[model samples]
Target: MAFNRTRWAALAATVVLAACGGGGGDIVPSPRVPFTSLVSFGDSLSDVGTYKVGTVAAAGGGKFTVNSASARIWTELLASDIKVPASCPAQTGLLPNVPGFTGAPVTNTPACTNYAQGSARVSNVFAPSSATLQAAPFNQVNIGLTAVPVTQQIAAHLAKTGGSFNGSELVTVMAGGNDTFMNINGVSAAAGGGAAAAGAAVAAGWPTATQQAVAAGGAAAVNAAATAAVTAMGQAGAELAGLVKTQILAKGAKYVVVVNLPDVSQTPFALAADAQTRALVNQMVTTFNSQLAAGLAGTATTVVQVDVYARGRDQTANPSRYGLSNVTTPACSTTSPANPLQGSSLACTTASTIPGDTSGFLYADSVHPTPLGHQLQNQFVKEQLAAAGWY
Candidate 1:
């Protein structure tokens, strides 16, 4: 399938990023939009806590692998800008936490207003923009649940009064994991006893299936769904980019950055059940990315895709180096039932928890990043942001 760059270009999207195919894969962070603020949109990875106490699941607020410093990804990007075209050291609430260095946070959206919410889907909550009369998720700021997809999130943001942002102010998107998980779990349910079989395998538990549809070919089912998901996400990316360009970039948002999907096959959660399954997961992930690249094809917009998966793709080979603790069971210990599995780490504690740590590598439970895991992503995001000139 020849990649259709024509359509992508038709949308005025432009990717300044270079191919990551060769050499030792040097870190490439993109230049930040030199804007006053970075209004984010998406799920847990980007969610600051829009859904925190709203309770689709009633879970706590954003506590994933935050560096604990004010330097969360967004914050860090804005932190040390002695060289940024013409900006002050990102004001309070700007970017995220700063690392190793802790102090009062300088904010980009200091009004306590950044669109990001932990665990939020692109379209979760149908959250209204009035701010005063928001949805359950918006009230607290969890961003998770709402069990929505990325496309919807974009629309919802557009619906908000202040949600409409432009040029540089809207920085990036880090979403779509839950969509994949939901797809995977749906496939598992199709195979009778699939849930129980998967459940019984590791000490930690797998997500309960909401559907009973199985992949026509077992693991193949997951592969098919993955392909569909990638396709859907790609289409969503293009469409959302359309909104970004017209609504934000054209008006002034300047740049719209997005974090690419990582290697799905590499996740311990998928691999633990079956080695073959793992390989399939990885393969589909790669295949899906190809489709995604095409979807993001030729727009004049600066579209940079980061290989976040590569960072964790070969974890078995080098988990320790990336700060990954590489555990087998889903972060949950069979012996300790009291520990409520949180994010991807499989560990139980909330704050003390970091992603990729063996403590919860298996059971951080949320089908997504444990705060520690997010730390790993933060590293990838920062590096890519630099590569994309977001620094």
Candidate 2:
């Protein structure tokens, strides 16, 4: 769904007084299952140091997006709270088949617990190479640093765990955000081609009013963009559902928490775009989440879906409830005018911030969350784990 700023602002103002003390209570450990480990697989949101060790992101005096030891991400906090051993995994090698891209020429270590990578996606393993690896804008790492998609990350974990879970591991999976992002980026790459493709199909007797409107550009190709994104997300969600079923649940995983894609339409990256572009991005995220939710429905596995999307939207819509002051702009400073959140987190210390302070800002950069944002995210996931009886 598109972001309704006026409506959310009204809701925020209306609930200001009522929500003063309505925030959820502290997270309490569950007694049902004494989960001993937190095995995570996802994107940068859950990554520990895959990017730092594998890619050039950390080469230019830039820290990995999730590398705040003092203020770690939700997964790190969850690991610490649940007492899971921390490990960092890195896969540095030449992409199987990319021109002029040398390998990192490094070996693997087995001490890594968090297999998540910064540019990982749900379907990257199935594909030859990820969009992040192939796309020029993302190929900053001259020595091709491959992103271990969730699929491959699980494979990496399974290689270590031998495709078997002891039922004591608290598996955390948060993917599909990059999947949705790549699909949205696909729309931009195609430009008006979506409209052209829809018009061609209509000309070939595929009669649909939506296609007709697409030809007229009445909806600015959003209909086509949404459809494309939904199809991609549906496929990704299906693969994710299958993986969770066979690789995780069937292998004796008892407590699995999968975080849904957040309302990225409200991220600084989305806000930097025009209103229509923001709406399209929002539509892509919502469609991805909807597909993922549907794929995870009616499963007997003890899989909990954390509604991070709703939680993030609520935090932005009602910042007062979360003690947030700036939910729109990023705390990091970007020199690029086109992408304001491109500022390096390593360089965005409190001294370098636009306001010289990041007290209540929700985001650290264009997309990633700040320490406070990560804390809020951890709280949400903790509540879900408590509700699911997974300690």
* Candidate 2 local lDDT, residue 368: 70
Candidate closest to the true structure, highest lDDT: 2
What tens digits encode model 1's per-residue C-alpha lDDT throughout 146-220?
333455545445555365554445356655454344334333433433443232211111222321222233554
Cand. 2 Cα-lDDT: 0.58
Q: Which stretches of candidate 2 lie over 4 Å from their true place?
A: 1-25, 29-32, 54-69, 90-106, 125-145, 192-226, 336-352
Per-residue lDDT, model 1, residue 264, is 55
Model 2 scores worst on lDDT over the 10 consecutive residues at 12-21
TM per prediction = 0.58, 0.76
Among residues 3 or more apart in sequence or in different chains, the pairs in candidate 2 whose N, CA or C atoms overlap within 3 Å are none
Pick the TM-score winner.
Answer: 2
In order, what is each prediction's RMSD in angstroms?
12.2, 8.1
**Which lDDT values do the candidates have, in the order given?**
0.39, 0.58
